[model samples]
Target: MPFDFPLIATIAAVFLLAGFVKGVIGLGLPTISVGLLSLVMAPAQAAALLIVPSVITNLQQMRPTATLLPLARRLWSMMLGVILGTLAAGGLIAGANAAGAAAALGAALVLYAAIGLIQVRFQVAPRHEAWAAPVVGGLTGMVTAATGVFVLPAVPYLQAIGLEKDALVQALGLSFLVSTLALALTLSGAGVFTWASVLTLVPALAGQVVGQWLRTRIDAVTFRRWFFAGLLALGAFLALRWLLA
Candidate 1:
């Protein structure tokens, strides 16, 4: 497959921005990259381009070996649900029309932005985690399979679990890692995975370095405000584009 220079350029720019967002917030690489990429390509294609960068960056975030095993044990049920749900919905995005997938992606982004901006929080009792985790994971996986975004109930559920700040970040990384791998498997099975996504790694990592450097100097809260606002607008535009098409 010949690389389209313009499309590649767009991808580079999008991943750079997406990586920067992830560096600061510890998430959003796939969500932002796929959401923006869907503007120019199908959701499945955008998802393909994101697989490599998402996996690498997420692995970087899941650090401090001591914490990983504990977190993994606690979240194993959710992780299992993620894999099952993603595989179940694997063909939905690949089989959908471009416009339909774009609309789904756009709607996911919009819902995510709304949740972030409004700061919606939920509480899951410790005893309920066994049941709650799998359900949330399954829904999140279905969302990822359909739209290539995996933040919705997953992020909210993580926050509600009352993890300490550091634990929350690491947990997020672990959950995202699981989701990315599940999505990758689904994409591969659906014939949407592409080795060409490797080309995006450089720009994505470069942007992440810069964003991490800036994270220490800036107010993440303020930046998050602007980020959600921008995402809200972008999502609205994409959804409306589909509606009016």
Candidate 2:
């Protein structure tokens, strides 16, 4: 846990890149950061370091609070399911050996990338949402607890339920915020949360600022394609490397 010069540099670089991705798409901070950091450290440790940055950055995404309450009310079942599922599976990653944790993280990244690349669209009828939301939420929470990434079924489910663009962004923020808080609690209970996690905030925040600035100049759609492609490669590398090791 000692932040030596090399380790500090690695953390700074990883967060900078991850933050940039999130700035452009309003997601990927935790996903990218945890995936990259797991290359050098245990997944549990990488996840611990991500807590502060993920919570803060996601909070920023939940802007224009005027519509927040209605979104929350609509998604409350899913949020509750996230909390329960996370709590139930809290020990999975922390209790795992380094190889197992790394492999799981890698697999999660690969799945996420595949989903993004496929760009599959699903429509959920309004009547079904009452039963569907919690199921998606619970699955997402279990995934979050295991891999420190929470965008799989949750993101797709949200998209399927039909929110406008702005509302979709805000909904993502809210869902992430809940997932993050729940993860933080579980990590803490597992004794994986470290005071050193706070040290990551400066570089992470700085990177997000730069990314947000660049977002205005770039074509996000093109960037997204490249991003998912890179993610797929990285995820494959990590999974293969550790599983074979």
* Candidate 2 per-residue lDDT over residues 1-245, each given as its tens digit: 65389988998899988888888888888888988898888888898998888888888899957899999999999999999999998967788576777787788778878888888889999999999999999999999888888887899899999899999999999999999999999999999987677777777888888888999899988898888888888888888997688
What ranges in model 1 sit over 4 Å off? none
Q: How accurate is candidate 1 locally (lDDT)?
A: 0.88
Q: Which candidate ranks first by lDDT, i.e. highest?
A: 1
Position 163, candidate 1: lDDT: 90
lDDT of 1 by residue, 85-139 (tens): 9988887778858788889888888888998899888888999999999999999
- The estimated TM-scores of all candidates read 0.97, 0.96
Superposition error at 191 for model 2 (Å): 0.5
lDDT value, candidate 2, whole model = 0.87
Clashes of each: 0, 0
